[model samples]
Target: MIYQIYPRSFQDSGDDGVGDLRGITARLPYVASLGVGAVWLSPIFTSPMRDFGYDVADYCDIDPLFGTLDDFDALVAEAHRLGLKVMLDYVPNHTSSDHAWFRESLTGKESGKRDWYVWRDPAQDGGVPNNWKSFFGGPAWTLDEASGQYYLHQFLPSQPDLNWRNPAVRAAMFDVLRFWMRRGVDGFRVDVIWLLAEDEDFRDEPVNPDWKPGDVEHASLDHIHTQDQPETHEYIREMRRVLDEFDDRMMVGEIYLPVVKLLPYAGTAEEPMVHLPFNFHLILQGWTAELVRGFADSYDAECRLRHSWPNWVLGNHDQHRFKSRLGADQYRVAQTLLLTLRGTPTVYYGDEIGMTDVDVPADRLVDPAALQQPDSPEAGRDPERTPMQWDATANAGFAPGGATPWLPLADDYPAVNVAAQDGDPASDLNYFRALTRLRAEYPALVGGAYRSLETPGADVFAYERMPEHGGGERVVVLLNFGGEAADVAGLAGGDTLLSSLGDRPERGAALRPHEARILRG
Candidate 1:
C-alpha cells in the first residue's frame, strides 16, 4: 500500500501552523508502521499558494512553509532507513505565473523564452483564442497585453500551461525530474500527464451534447482538444525513458480518462510509459457491490492484457474522503475491498483513522474552488484536506496549543485521532494495520491474480486471489455493502484471516452490515 501525505495538513514540527518536511520526517516511523511500501507526498514545492502548491514557482525548492531541501534530504534518509520508499508529486502541465521561466517568457514577444508557454493571438472578435473554458470557471485564455497575445491556462489564470511541444520546455522539465531523483526520491506521481499535450492545430473542442446549464462551466465543452490528445503518447513515452534511466524508479500518471483511453497511458508491450496510470474507479465508481466488482474485474483484465500493473485509489486531496462519500457504514467494507483487490492500493492521509469530511465554515473557507462557487454542492476539497488527527491533544497535535492550523482541525478529532484508534483493537486504524500486514505476508493477496466470485446477494461482493499457477495458499475477500447481514454462498473454506467487525468468522461467513472479511486456505 502507498500513503498520500498532503504536507500542509500532515504535521507541524515548527508550530508555524503549517506542516513541513521536518514534520514529515518526524512522522516517518508512524507511516512505516502502517506497512505501506511508499509514501507519496503531495506537492510541497515553492509556490504562491494560488491553487495551493499546484501552482509551482520553483520545481526544485521546498516551500519555506514546508521546510528546506536539507530537511527533505533528512526525510528521505529516515524513510529509507525505515525501509520505505519516497515519492514526490510532480506537476508538469502548468507553472506559476511567478516562475522565473514564465516571468521571462511574458517579458515580450521577442524574448528568448517567449515560446516556452502556449501563447496565441486573439481571435478576430478580440476574445479568448477559442471557446475553451478554464476548469476554475472562466475563459481558458488570459490576455497578456504586453506581448499582444493570450496565454492558455487550463485551470487558474495564474497557472499558465507550459508548451511541452517546445523542445526547450521539455528539457527543462526533464532536469527538474533529475533534481529530485538525485535527492533520493524513488518515484514521481505526475500530475495531469495527459494534459501535457494538446491538439497541435489548436482546434476548438466540440460542445458536449449532454451538458446542462447547471454543470461546471468547463464541462460545457467536450474538451476534445484540451485533453487526452493523441500526441500525449509520445510525451508519456519520453517521460518513461527519463524515469527508466534510474534503477527501480517509478512513474505514475494522474489520468481521468475512460479505461479504453487510459490504456495508452500504460503504453504498449514494446513502448512502456507510466508504471501506473492511477486507476481511480474506486473513487468514481458507484458505491455498490456489482458496480465495484465490475470496476475491479474490468480494470484488472485490461491491465493484464497490456502486461501493466494496476493501482487503486479510494480518495485523494482533490476528491471527497471515501468514508464521507460512501457513508460511515460502508467505510470498513471499502477498506477491505481496496486492500484485497489486486494491484497497488493508495491510502489517503487520515483514512487509516476513519476520518470523515469536515465542514469548512463559510468564514474560514480557504480553498479557491470553494470560494469561487460558495453555493455549489461540491464546492471545494477543503473538507478532505483537513489536518491529520495524530493525537487527542490540542489542535489534534498538528499545531501548537495557541497556533491555528492552515486548515481547521476536524470536529471529531478528539475521538478519532490516531492515538485513540491505535489503542483500540476494533478501530479502523487497527483493522487497516491487520489488512496491510496480511497483504505483505501473502503473495496471493499481493501479486497473485484476481477473479470475482459470485455471491448469493447483490450487496455482497466476493472475490478470490490465488497464485497464477495454482498450489500454495489463496485468499478469499468478501465485502457486504447492504445494511443487513449477508450469508454469502460459495465462499471458499478457509480460516478467517481478518474481519472488519472484529469477529473471525469461518467459511461461508454471515457478515454484519457493511462488514468485510479475508479468509486464507
Candidate 2:
C-alpha cells in the first residue's frame, strides 16, 4: 500500500500554486485509482526552499519548484504506466546550505570539500560543540563566520549535517540512489534514516530523565549523541547495498525508533536493511483500543522476533490529522487500523478522504518548525502540510483561481473533497475505495499472520489475518475504539467483509459505535 505524496501539496501543474512533476503526472490517474502499490514522492530534489524540500540543493537536478528533468521523466513515465510505483523523498540526512556540496564545504579550512560538512572547533566555552539541540530550535551548532568553524545543523540552519563518515558522502548518496533507480524509482522513503550516523566521539547527549516543563527543545536531550549510531547500522547496510542494485528496488527507512530500535532497520536477515523500518508506532501512540492492542501485540511480537517485515503508518507529512487526531468518529477507526495491519501500509495524502488539520493562521505560517517554535505544541507543520483536497473549486482544487496556496484550504474543503468523496458511497472517499478493494481481494490481507484476537473488553481491538503458509480465508479485524457499544462475541463463523459504518453483521457480531468490522473466517 504505500501512498505518501506531499510534493508541494500534491497537484498543481503550472497553474502554479506549487505542486509539480506535471502535477504528479496529472495525478497519475488519481494515483492509479487508489489501490496503491507505491507512490511516496515528498521532495522533488534541487531545493533551497529551506526546509520545504527538506533542504536538498540538487542531488541530480529537478526542482524548478518541482518540474523539469523532463518533468521527472514524465513522472516516471506516468508512474510506470499506471500500475504505479514511484517513491522518492530520499533526503539522506541533510545537504543544501545551498549545496554545491554545501557550497564546496563553505570554501575555507583548505577546502577539499572541507571534510564535506559537520565541521567543529568552537567548544572550550566559546559555545556549541555539543549540547546539541536544533531539531528546529536553538543550537545544533552553526557559527561558521568566515570558516572559524561550527556547522552541524540537525534540522535547519539551512540544513548542513552530512558527512556520513564521508566516503565521499557515501559515494554521493549511493549516486542519489542510482539516479532514482535509473529513473524508474520503485522505492525509497529514507529522509532522516536515523540521521545517517552521528556521535563519532562528539558526545554530550544524556539529559532527558523524562524532560517535562512543556517539552520540545529536541525533547531536552537524551538523543544519545544525535540518534541511533553504531555507524547507523553500517549506513543502513550501505543503503541496503544500494537498493540491492536495482531490480524491484525497496528502501523505506524514516525511522523514529522503538520497536526495539525499529527492528535493526530490518537488517541481519543475512544483512538486509530498510525494506521497511518505518513503523512509527501508529504515529507515536495513544489512540486507545487498549493502546492499539498493546501496540499491535508488541509490534507483531517484535516483527516475528526479527525476521522483520512489518510496517504501518497512519498519517504523515509529520503529525496531527489522524482525522485531526482521532475525531470525525475515529476516521473509520483509523482507516480500519491502517488497512488491517500486519505489515506494509503508509497511506497519507489527504488520508483516504477524511483530511483535517488546516488551521495555520498568524498570517499563513509557513513552517520552519512553525517559524522556529511559534509557541511549540510540537512546532507547527503548517497544519499538516495543507493542499491536495482536489475538488470544491478555488484553491481547494489546490491551485490556479489566482494561485496562492502554499498552504491553506481546509475549511472542510467543501464537504471534504476528492470530488465530494467520489460521489459518496458512504464517503471517506468511498470508504477508501472499499478499503483498497478490501486490500486487493484479500490473500488474508496480502500476506497475513498477525494474531491478537480475544477482545471482549478494553474497547475492542481484535485481530486475526492468518494465511502466511496455510489455506486462505481467515480475516477477523473488529476495531471499535470506544464510543461505547462493542460486543464482538468472538465469532468463529465468517462473512461480514468490511464495515466501519457500512455494516452487514450477523453470526455473533455487535460493534456499532465507533465500528470497524472485516471478518472472513
TM-score each candidate: 0.98, 0.36
lDDT of 2 at 13: 69
- Native-vs-model 1 lDDT? 0.88
Model 1, 1-521: lDDT tens per residue?
Answer: 78999999998888788888888898999999999999999999999998889999999998988888899999999999999999999999999999999999988999888899999999999988888888778798999987679999998889999999998998999989999999999999999898988788888889888977656777788898889977788888988888888999998899998998887798877899998998887887688888988888898899888888988889999999999999989998888888888899989999988999988888878888777655464858899999999988899999854579988888889999989888888888999999889987888988898998888888988888999887668888888899998776468478888888898876765777888888885
Please give the CA lDDT of all the candidate structures.
0.88, 0.82
Say which candidate scores most in TM-score: 1
- Displacement of residue 358 (Cα, Å) in model 2 is 25
Screening candidate 1 with a backbone cut-off below 3 angstroms (N, C-alpha, C), the clashing residue pairs are none
TM-score of 1: 0.98
Per residue, candidate 2 scores C-alpha lDDT tens digits across 296-401 of: 8888887888888888887898787788788888888888888878788988888888888987788888788877876676777878888888888788777855
Point out where model 1 deviates above 4 Å.
none
RMSD of each: 1.2, 20.3
